[model samples]
Structures are given as C-alpha cells and as structure tokens.
Target chain A: MMRSDDLVMLYSGPDQVDYAYLSPETAGVYQNKHGSFQHRSLVGKAFGTRIRASNSDGWVDALAPTPELWASAVRHRTQIVHQLDAAVVCFELGVRRSSVCAEAGTGSGAMTGALSRSCGSVHTYEFNEARATAAQGEFERNGLTNVTVRHCDVCEEGFRDLDVDSVDAVFLDLPEPWRALPHALRVAKPGARIATYSPCVEQVHRTRDALSTCLDLRTLEVRQRDFVVKDVLLETGLAPPAKRRKDYQNEDDAPRRYANCAFLAWF
Target chain B: MVDAGDEVVLWTSQGTYLFAEAKVGSTFRWTKRERVRVDALIGAPFGATFEIRGGALVRAAPRGAATTVEDDGERRDNRWLADDNRAQRLDADDLKRMRRDGASGEAIIDALVAGSDTFAHKTQFAQQKWLRRKQNKYLPWVRVLEPRAATIAAAYFSRGNLLPHRVVLRPDTVAQLVARANARDGAKIITVDHSGGVALAAILERIEPSGKALVPHRGPFEALRRCNLTDLDRRVVCFSLDETPPPQGDSLVLVAKTDPIANLDALLPLLCPSAPIVVYSDTVEPLAAAYAHLQASGLATAILLSETWLRDFQVLPNRTHPTMSMSATGGYLLSATKIVVADAA
Candidate 1:
C-alpha cells in the first residue's frame, strides 16, 4: 500500500505520466487530462492501483516511480536524456546494484535519475549552481537518497572534490568530454566501463583519439524503434492515427539539449 | 575469485563464446588441439585467460589483446583473382593429416594461408576480411567470463539453431524490452519467457534487492541454472502455467518462440490497468493477431508495434566501417499500456 510522502507515478496513458505527492493535510483535487481525484482518497490504495476520476470520468493507475517513468515525466529543466540512450548507456556501462558511478555536467538531472536507479550510488557533478541546487531538491522530493548533486565543473578539476577517487563506471554528457577523459580515467577503477553521449560525430572521433591505446572500440547509434508493425488494428479512440510512426514522436518534438549519440569504450 | 564448479563462459580471442563449468575433472575442448583441463581455472578470477600447454589448462600471459594490428599490406591487389574452386592447394586429406597431428590453430592458419593459390595476391582489405573470418574458427586461446545472463544469452546465440522470434530477446534487445516494461523497484513483473531465460535475467540484473518476478514456463527452467544467479529463491518463483495462477503485476513480458497469442491471453489478465505490456516475435502474423485482439477489445491504448535492427560500426583510425557481418533481424515487438474501459453491462 502507498503511504504519504511516497513518490507516485500516476498514469493516464502509455506516454502520459504525472507526479503526485500524497499528504493528508494537503487534501485537494489532483488534476490532469485523465481526470481529477481527491488527494486524500489515495492514501491507503495499493500501488499499480486504479481509481476513477471524480470529475473527468476517466481513470488513472497509481504506479511505482521508475527511472523510465521519471525520464518521461520529470519536468524538463533541460533537454533530458532520451530513455533509449539511457538504457544503452546503463547496459554498456555495466552498472549494477554494487557499482559506484560518477557523472559530469548533470544536465536537467535526467541522466542522473537513470544512473541513480541503475547503480549503488551516484555522485553527480553539475557546472551550473542553479541546476545543481534544483536537482538536489528534486532528488530529495523523490526520496532518492543514493544520489549526491554537487556544483563543480568536472572537466575543469576532475571528480576529486567529492572525496571519491575510484568508481566502477563513469558517464560524460558534456559538450567537450575529451578534456575530462584523463580525470575520469584517474578515478575509474581498473577495467572500469566508460561511456559518453555526444550529439555530433566529430566529438566521437575526438573522444576516440583521446584514448588511442584502447582496442576494438565500438560506436553505436540506437535509433528509437519506429517501424510500426504492419496489420495491427487501430481504432480512432485507441490510437491517434495510422498515418506514420513519426506522429508518435510529436509529443517529444521539443529540441533536446544533450545525448544525441553514444560512444562506449572499455578499459 | 571464482571457486570450484563455478559456471563460466569461455570467450575466444576471435569472438566465439561457449558456456563451460569449472569442474574438478572435466575437460573443455575448444578444438582438437585445445582440450584444456578445467581444474586449473578453479580459483582464477573472471576475465583471466587460459591456454592449453601440454594438455593442461594454465593461466596465460595477456597476448597484447590490444589494438587490432592494422597492416595495409601493399604486396598484391585482388583484381585478377577468380573463384574457380581451386584457390587452395591443400587438399582435404592434407588438411586432415595436419589436424590429426595436433597442429595449433595459428599453425593451421599459417598452413592454409601458405597453401592458398590466391591468398598473397588478394587486396589488403580482402586479406583482413579473410583473416577475421578464419580467426573466428581457428583461435584457441580463451578468456573466462562470468556466466551472467548476457554471457549465457550470447553463448546460446553463437551456438545457433535458434527460433527467429527468440533472437530479439538477446542481449541488446533484452535491455530495451526491460525499459519498455517500465520495470522499477518493488514492482511485480510477470514474465512468460520462451527464449530460455534472457528476458528474466535482464530484468533481474537491474531490479535486484527489490522487486519480485514470477516466471510461468513449461519445463524445469534448466536454462536459468546457466545464469548462476544467487538469491534466486527469494527474487523469482517458477511454476508451470497449468499448475497455478500468477499474482497480478505492474508489467508484462511475452517472448514466445511459439505463437504469442496463447501466452498473451493467459498473462494479460494479471496485468493491472495502465500497466505496460511488451510482446516480442520475429514474425508479424502472430503479433498482428495479438495486437488486434488487444486493440479491438479496448483493453490497451497508446499501442505501438515496432521492430529494430542494430548495426555495429568498427572505429579504426584510417579504416572505419560497419562490421563485415551484421544481423539482419531483431524481430518485432508489440507494446501497449493496458487501460480500464467501462463495462457496457
């Protein structure tokens, strides 16, 4: 059962997600396109729990918050990392429950949300103070105690200020990750897995040049699966239109700032 | 350090992998001349390399395993080469005799190259390609990797005769499927795996120390043992679908080698409203039926059916291109969010 202060991901559609913080004191109607429901009514309901909207006549399911959902629903303080890139990065980095990870230039705290859930603990460094403070507050609100948001330029000084010298994995979402490779390698454990997300191909070449000794480097561009399966029925209310798969991407059409491509290298 | 009887994937330097147990008295045969006893690797750490020295397995020195030696040999170009089936001078019996005498993989490769009528005359690019293809077969050195889900799935994929529908449930695709399921901590994930246990292992790796997964498979789930997962009793419960009903879950996954229509009918009821559902199949016929059923029934919305094929690029200084061989298919996946519809009754 869900308790007050537990982070809840309320869903009205597959892609439509909204955050709801439950408290008995702030008893009011929670509103979204799905419907409106009383905040107090959700206090004792089970998770993956459904309740009818008192006003919109539609319904929403109360589900547990995951990194994928958070990536979709979190307020876009900056263009967040796409879930596809995040998934590939998480896997290629080999992060697990026992790993310690570090990130640079925490843009919008989006990728950090993924890294936090994937590994044991994350020490995220952001160059911007405002973004750093904002992400810290957001993590606290979501009750994520395993993340630490610090205001530091990792490219400038390295991951030394946080007092952690070595980590199991490292991720760089900065514009110029070549400068931080030496610093990242310094703190990364021997045989640590490292991945970088850059928007351009030239950055991949420059990043590859920084580690000339590494062998058998692989570069992958994981496109979102868009070729719609043929011959599936589509009623008017169920699906938007049967025209094209690009139509589904209209919701996320806003220009994204970080994570255009991924460069993964094993050391 | 791995102990005795631990399962490990013996990874070849040339990119072939197989699952083997570090048993006390068993022998792992990579090739005729590379049957090394497994007892020496009993306590060696994972990622350690083992070589066959006098029929005994022993830790071998790292073979530079570094950068691919880029040698653009300019001796001869292959413009005049013709494929009339007489390109190799070594006949079948000669090759058989060389193998019977226990020639090393490298020695065999050298003999083959020397005996070839057109090998030295081929272009640098063609020569490299030929070397790479031969290396996959003749390389004898092995690296011991932990037999995790990814490794096991890769090893199974390398050893073929697989159902096309099951290929998408391989390593990279499994990661994407888990994301599509919206798997999280403490959430119940119901899986119907027909691809051995790739889907289950992918989810378990990410949501460890938290969630519970119930797998309804038909057999003994013998493949799950290959993953060598610890704490399996608490995290997963296995049963035959004919025996009992599974608890309702937040998400559903169906990767069926047979038709997925039957599995979806049985598992869809356990998913709550707004739960994400992912169905994988190599053919669109079965998934089309399953997709239409969910759509016409008003049981799911925001439904998207799609498939993806990944191409890997080799990044080298002067010669970068897609690898010579690429997998043509990753299969189809039908995904949707289950929603509640008011009953007309």
Candidate 2:
C-alpha cells in the first residue's frame, strides 16, 4: 500500500494526469472532471487502484510515478531536458547500475531524476541555491535517495565534494561546458565517458576543442520527426471528373513538423 | 568486428560511403580515379586514417562528427566575377596525378589554389567554397562506423530508403519515444515497432532484464535479429498481430505504423491507469482521430500533444544560420496519459 509522502500519478480524466505527492497530514483533495477525492483516501490504497470521492461520483487512479511521468508532471522552473536528450546523454555516458555519475547546472532536475533511475548514484551540482534546494526536496519527496543535489557552482569550484577520479561518467548541461572540462577530467576515471549538451555550435566548438586533448570527441544533434497517421476518405465532387472526392479529406489533418535541437558532445 | 568481409562506412571530407571489405589483394575503388587495397583497412581502427597506393590518405571518420570546415579570417565583399577570369593553371591530368601520387586532401587543395591564376582575386567566401569543393574531391579519409541503429538509420534515411518502410524515426525520435514511455528496469512496455525493430531495440536497451516487452508483429523479426538483441529476447514476448496478449499490466504503450485507436483500445484496458500511451505516425489524421476518441471516451487526459520536429544548424562565429537543406518531415508524436473512468453514482 502507498504511504504518506509517496509520489503518485493521479489520473482523473483523459486530459488530467497530475503528479501528486500523497500527504496524510494535510488535507489535499484532488479535483477533476469526475469529482474530488482527498489525499487521505489515497494513502492506504494500492497503486493503480481507483479511489472514489465521498461527496460525488469523482474518482482517480493513483498510479506509481516513473521518471518520465515525473518529468512531465513536475513543475518546470527552468528549461528542462526532455526525454530524448536525457536518454542520449545517459546512453553516451554509458550509465549503468553501479556507475557513479556527475551532472552540472541541474536546471529542473529532470535529467537528475533520469540519472538517478539508471545509475548507482548521481552527484548533481546546480549553481542556483533555490533551484538546488527545491530539487533536493523534490528528489526526497519522490524517494530518490540515489541522487544528491548540491547547491554549488561547479564551474568555479568543480566537483570537489566527490573524490578525485572517482566518477564513472559526467554530464554537462552548462552554458560554458568548456569551463568545467578540467574539473570533469579530474573527477572522471580513466576511459570514463563524458557528454555535454548545447544548443549553439559555438559552444559545441569550444567544448570540442577543450575535450580534444584528453578525450576522443564526437558530436551529434538528436532530431525527432513525428507523423500523424490518418485514414483518408475519398469523395467525389460535382464540378469535374478529375476533382472526385478524396478519401480522408480533413483539411486540418495536414502533417505538421516540430524540431528540438540539442548538440551532444561525447568522449 | 573489423572482419575481412564486413561492410563498413568510410566517412570522407566529401561524403560517406558504404565499403565492403574483400580479400587482402582486392582493391576497393573509392572513385573512378581513386582506389585502395582492402588489406589497408582490414585491421585498422575505425577512426584512424591510412595511406593508400599513392600519397593519398584516408581516415575512418568518427561517428556523429560533422565535416570539419575551418573559417579562415579572410575578408572580402560579395562581388560578381567574370567567367573569363576563372582560369586554372593546373590541368585535370596534373590534378589527378597529384591525387594518385598520395598527396593529402589539404595538399591537393593548396596545389589547386596555387595553380589558379585568379585564386587570390576571389572573395574569401568564394575561396573557401573553392577549397571545400577541392577537399571533397581529393580527401580520401573514410571513418568506419559499426552498424548500430543510429548509423544504419542515418545511412538509410540519407539514401531515401526509410520511406518505403514508413519508419522515418530518427535517433532523437527513438530516444524520445523510449524515454517518454518511461521504459526502464522492471517496467512493462508494449511496443508496435515498424522501423525494422530499431525502436524496439532502443526500448530494450533502456529497459532490460527486469522489464518485459510485448512485441506483436506480422512477419519474421528480422529487425530485432539484425540488432543482435538475442540476449534480451527472453525478456521479450513476441506474438502475431491477431494474437491476444496475455493479461498483464503494461506501464507504457508505444504504437508506430499501426492503427493507434485500435491498438490503444485493445491495449488500454491492460495498462495501469495513468500509463502513458505514445503514438508515432508519419501523418497526423489517425492520431488526431485517436486523440478525439480518447477525449470523447474520457480514457486519457493531460496535454494531448502532437509535436513535429525541426532541426537547425548553428554554423558558429560568422555563418550562424539554419542549414540550407534538411528533412522536411521528421514525423509526429502523440503523447497522453491513460485514465480509467469509474461508473458515475
């Protein structure tokens, strides 16, 4: 049974999947299209089980929270790394169970959560104290004990809190990854992989140059293209034989395009 | 493995090539004028360069590294040049012989510049373009890459072969789909992969051992076979499209190149409420219909998003702009969280 402070994905309707923290002490009722249900009612229930409201016909499914769900449901104070870039960074870094990883400039802790899920431990450094504290609380609330959120500027001080040459991988999401290269190198074990994410080529070039001496550098950008699938209905028109009715003639169903650009440098 | 008969990619300055290694004495012709012994590359490291018969050297290009183009600080205003002034001092035969004699790409480019009577008079941009053109022609470097999903997908997409299969999923798209689905350790995921199992392989890579995948397909699992994922096969339960999946709670449902509505309808009941259902298609009509169906039925909620991908290249210092050419359509994604509706009072 789920207990107090357990993070759950509360599903009330097709459009309302909320990431909620279960608290027995405070009276927090989750209201949705169906009805309202108190957090207290959800505490003793098993995950994925439906809970009903006392006053009305409202019900919500308290589902277990996964990293992806948390990422989508979490509050975003900064531009967060979406799943695509995070996965690539993890893969490029060769993050595995038992691998100790390091991250700098933890923007929203989205990647921090992802790393925490995959690796043995993550030492994430965020320059902004407030964000770091907030992330630390979020991690704790989510029961992510594997992650340690530090309110420190890694660019100036480096990952000095960790042992030198102890880290197995490093992920840099900083504006100036080149600045942290020395510290990353110091913390990284021999042949340990490193990955840096940047949107601009100038930053990539700088990072590439900085890593050239010590690491075998390779750079790439991950681009995902999404297509909408529809069944076309052909129809005939009265005007001309050539203008016969076309199948699936929804004018608004035209294919649309969206692109996310994140430059990844791995060595 | 860098075996004698394996197909490898040779990334040169101009473009990438798929080279099949033959016996030791066999010569691999790079071009009509350029050829190298297969033995030269048989045992070499993937990204290392080797000298050929002549002075020409070819390096196996590193994976994901863009072709290097250094911008020299040479300033010139845009000006139209007369065709008559574009005279070359070195003839075609001499240039070909220089390449045959083992001159490097840079050396050949320098010779071309020195041989051009009007080279100095051209604008910096024009000079750079000229150098690029020459370098592409003379550079013999080729980086061999292992045939992973990303490299193979890129090569196939570049060759326009990804269309017939209706699997235009890029590396980024695969990564996004896997992550968004939250396919991790012990997570149960249902995948309908049409991209030659590349998507499935990516999912398996993320969620292994403890995680289970229900893959329903119509034909032989050639894609999965090619990925060398036999080790993870035990964790995967394969079935035909007509077969019913065993009753189990799946945390994620990933649909590609299939009917999203029908698949979701069949699979939604087996998913844990609040499970994410990610649908990918080349077009949007079906997904839009599925979104409407989900909303109308109150089966899912949160943001029902349809995102299209656009990639732009930042060329750095001076030439910072979007690339002139890119794939117009990467694809579209429809992501939503599933919800279970209880009977009203």
Candidate 3:
C-alpha cells in the first residue's frame, strides 16, 4: 500500500509522464498538459486508479513509483545514464543484492537510484556540492534509506572518508576517471569489478593506460535501437485497418520508399 | 561454492561451453582426446578454472586472470611470413611423441613455437590467436561458473537458442526487463516464465531479502531443479493458471513464448494499482499486437513498445573494431504501468 508522502508517477498518455508527491499536508492539485486533479482526490485511492480532472474530461493513471520510470521522467540537471548503458553496466559489474557498490560524480543521482534499488548499500559521491545535496534530499524524500550521499572529490579524498571499507563494485562517471582509479582500488574487494563510462576514445585510452596493471580488464560498448511497432495498410480502397488510423507502420526507409503502404502506429 | 549434484556451467569461451553436473563418477569430454572427471569440481569455488590432466580436473589459474587474448605488442607483422609447409617443422609423429611423453599443453605449445620457422614473424595478435587455438586443443581448461540467472541466460544466449525448452532472452534484454519491472527490494512479483526457469530466476534474484514471487506454474516447475535455490528462493509461491487467481502483486512480468494477448487478460486483474508491468517476447509482431490490445482496452498507461539491439566490439591494440558476428535481435520488451479505474483494481 502507498503511504502519504510517497512519490507517485502520473502517466497521462503517450510520452506524458508527471510526478505527484502525495503529500497529505500540501492540499493542492497536480496540473499537467493532460489534466489537473486535486491532490485531495488522490490521497487514499489505490495506486492504479484512473482519476479524472475535476473541471474537464482529462484523466491520468496514478501508478506506483519505480526507478526506471523516475529516470525517464526526471528533470535533467545533467546527462544521465540511459537504460541501454545502465543495463549493460550493471550486468557487467555483476551487481547483486548482497553487493555493496559505490559510484563517483553522481550526476542527478539517476544511476545512483538504480544502484541503490538493485544492491544492498550505495555510497554515492559527487564532487559538486549542489548536486550532492540535491541528490541526498531526493533520496530522503523518496524513502531511499539505504543510500548515503557524500560531497567530496573522490579522485583526491577517496571513498574511505565514508563508512565503506570494501565494495563489490565501483562505477565512475567522472571527466577524468583515471585520476580516481587508485581511490577506487582502495575500497574494492578481491575479485571486485570496476566500470568507467566514456563517450570518447581518448578518455578510454587514458583510463586504459591507468588501468593497465589491473587483471581481466575489458573494453566494450553496447547500443540499443528501439523499433516502432505499427501496422501497414495498403492504399487500396478496401476497408481501412481496424486499429486507430494514427498507428503508423514499421517501414524500412533505407533503400526506397514504397508509395501504396500506409504506415499507421508508431509504438 | 558448488556442491555435489549442482549443475555448473563449464565455460571456455563464448563459443565453447558445456553444462554439466558436479556429481562425482561422471566425466565430460570436450574433444576426441580431451576429457575430465567431475570429482575435482564438486567443491571448487565458482569462477575458478581447472585443467584436464590424465582424465582428471586440476586447478589452474582463476578464470580470466590468465587470459591469453590480451596482446599489445605489434612490432612484427605477417608481411615476411609465408603460408607454406616450411612454417612449422613439427610433424604428426612429433606431436604424438610429445603427448606420449606426458608434456603439458603449455610445454607442447612452447616446443611448437621453438620449432616453428615463422612463429617470431607473426604479429602479437596473430601469436596470441595461434596460442589460444593450440592451448584449447591440447590443454583444455574451463571455468566453473555459478548457475546464476544472468550466467545461465548468457550461456544459453551465446548458444544461439539451440534448445527449444530454454528461454531465448539475451542478457541485455533480461537486464532491461528486470530494470523496467522494478522488482528489486521486497516487492511482490507475479511472474510467468516460459523460458524454462531462467526468466523467473532472474526476477527472484533481484527481489532479495524479503521479496516474494508468485509464479504461475503452467507445467513443470523446472526452477526447482535447474536453479541453485536456497530456502528463501523456494518461497516463490506457485499457482495454476486456471486454479488459483493470479496472486495480487506489486509487479507483473510475463516472458511468454506464446502470444501474450490472452495471458494479459488473466494476469492483469490482480496486479496492485499503479504497478509497473513488463511483457517480453522474442518476436516483434505478437508484442506489437499485445501493445495495441493493451492500448485499446485501456488496461495500461505509459506504454512503450521497444526492442534492444546489441553490437559487440572487439577491442585490442591496433585491432579495435566492431565484432564481425552479432545477433540480429537482442529481444523485445513492452513496458508500461498498470492502472485501475475501479474498486480493487
């Protein structure tokens, strides 16, 4: 059951996601492009209820909050890790519920939320004081008690400043991750894994050079392409497709475009 | 650590693997000449490599710590090397004699290198490639991998869906599906696993500590036999698809091998309001139909029908490029949030 002050994700429609903190004290309405519903109206309702707007026909689904949806709907303070990279990184790190993991430069605490959700404890550090404070506050408000956020330059001070002595895995999303390798190694247990995310090849080269002494280092990248599922209806004068006309067809527009095919749904 | 009767994954490479029982008095043969007894691996820790010697398993370096594919030096190229009979001086009788003399695989490789006329002329990468091929042949070694959900999924995935009974999910798809479901922590999950048990095991692996999973046992409950489950893991409640109502759950996951359009009808009623719902399928058309069905029926919101495409890269010094081999489909996932507009929804 969802308690008061719980963070709820409001799904209004396609690509329409909003957040509603069911704060009992704050008597207000959550207004979005899809609709506006009174916070009082949603206070005690079950999470999956579809509530209609008081003044209009607009309605939204009040769904339970999860890290995956939060990442998609979070207001970006910085470029966060998407599901594609996050999935691969977590799998490569072999993260588990018993694993104690740490992360550096917790930008927006997006990946930090995921780590805390997946593992036992998360010691997330950020060099920037503002981001760290905001992340800590967010974690607290979200009831993520298993996470401890710290504001320190991990490259210089290291993770030992916190209570964490050994970790199962550590992820670095810093600009110069090479500078933080020694600190990462200090807290890593035997057979621990480390992951560094770099968009460019030069940073990867520098990081590899710094990590040359480590055993079993692998350099890899993963990509995910989403295909829109739809129905294609021929332009023939027969009865139109049963589904909505807005559903576009999945077309391969590489070589040549077909004229008679009416693509409908873009899922 | 593995115990007797545990099913362990013997991994040599992505392309070479074998699933074997850890019970003693059994033997696995990798090649015509390479075979090892299972007794030595019964109590060994996962991720440790053991070599086959004299038809018995012996401890080798830990898995990946002694990888031979890593080579940086490229001072010499194959420009001066000729693909002729003169490159290797070792004949068939010489190899047989070396084997008869009880030379280890590494020693034989070293002697072969000493006798080769062009071993020094090959590039570092070429030498590493030659060494890997020869080492795997003469001195077979395999890492004893724990049969975790992710590990099992990877093993089956690299095998390219050879078994019809196993789930055809790629590791990427499995990870993403688990992420989308948000089944971590102590959330109650309603899972329908058709990929034997790998799908259910993956979810149960995440909802740790006090988490509970209610699996609809359509047929055989293979998870009990296939996975290394503790007492807590067996807490996964089972119900028939027809007998008991789909247990009310905070999360719902269906890795269906069949069309999901009808299964959704039976499973959607008991899902807790406002929970995440994830449906995975290997093919796209069925999932597309399911997406439309969910949309038309208004049983779901915030639905996104998407698939994951993976491309592997071969990273080596002066040999960095995308791998030549890749699977066309990593698997597809339809992610959405379930909603209720009525009582007990």
Query: In model 3 chain A, where is the ten-residue run with the lowest total lDDT?
Result: A258-267
Instruction: Determine which window of 10 residues in candidate 2 chain A has minimal summed lDDT.
Output: A251-260
Candidate lDDT scores, in order, read 0.72, 0.68, 0.74
Cα lDDT of model 2 by residue, B238-330, tens digit: 755454555454555554666888888877777766667787777777777877787687666553445535454544346556667766666
> Which TM-score value belongs to model 3?
0.86
Report the lDDT tens digits of candidate 1 across residue range B1-345.
678878778877667876778888887776675566788888887767776666677798653233243576556766787879899988889878987898877898898899998887776666776776665566546777776555666677676565453443545666678777876666688887777666777777777778877777543444567767788888887655565454778889887676677777787888876688988887777777887788787667556666655667666555666677877766777887776643321
Which candidate has the top score in DockQ?
3
lDDT (Cα, tens digit) per residue for candidate 2, span A65-124: 877666666788888887667767775565656589999988899889898877888999
Segments of candidate 3 deviating more than 4 angstroms: A1-4, A162-165, A213-216, A236-267, B1-7, B13-15, B20-26, B32-34, B38-45, B62-97, B114-120, B218-226, B242-246, B342-345
For each predicted model, how many residue pairs clash, with residues at least 3 apart or on different chains?
Answer: 0, 48, 12
Q: Give residue A132's error in model 2 in angstroms.
A: 4.1
Question: What does candidate 1's lDDT look like per residue over A1-267, in tens digits?
Answer: 678877787776646778878876877567887678777667776665666787766887666676777777888877778777787778767677788999987878878888887789998988888889999999999877899888888888888554445798888888888889888878877556678777666787788887664433567666545443334355567656656654344454332333244544444
The superposed Cα distance between candidate 1 and the true structure at residue A117, in angstroms, equals: 2.6
True contacts kept of 2: 0.22
Q: Sort candidate 2 into its docking category.
A: acceptable
lDDT (C-alpha) at residue B117 in model 3: 90
Chain A TM-scores of each predicted structure, in the order given, are 0.83, 0.83, 0.84
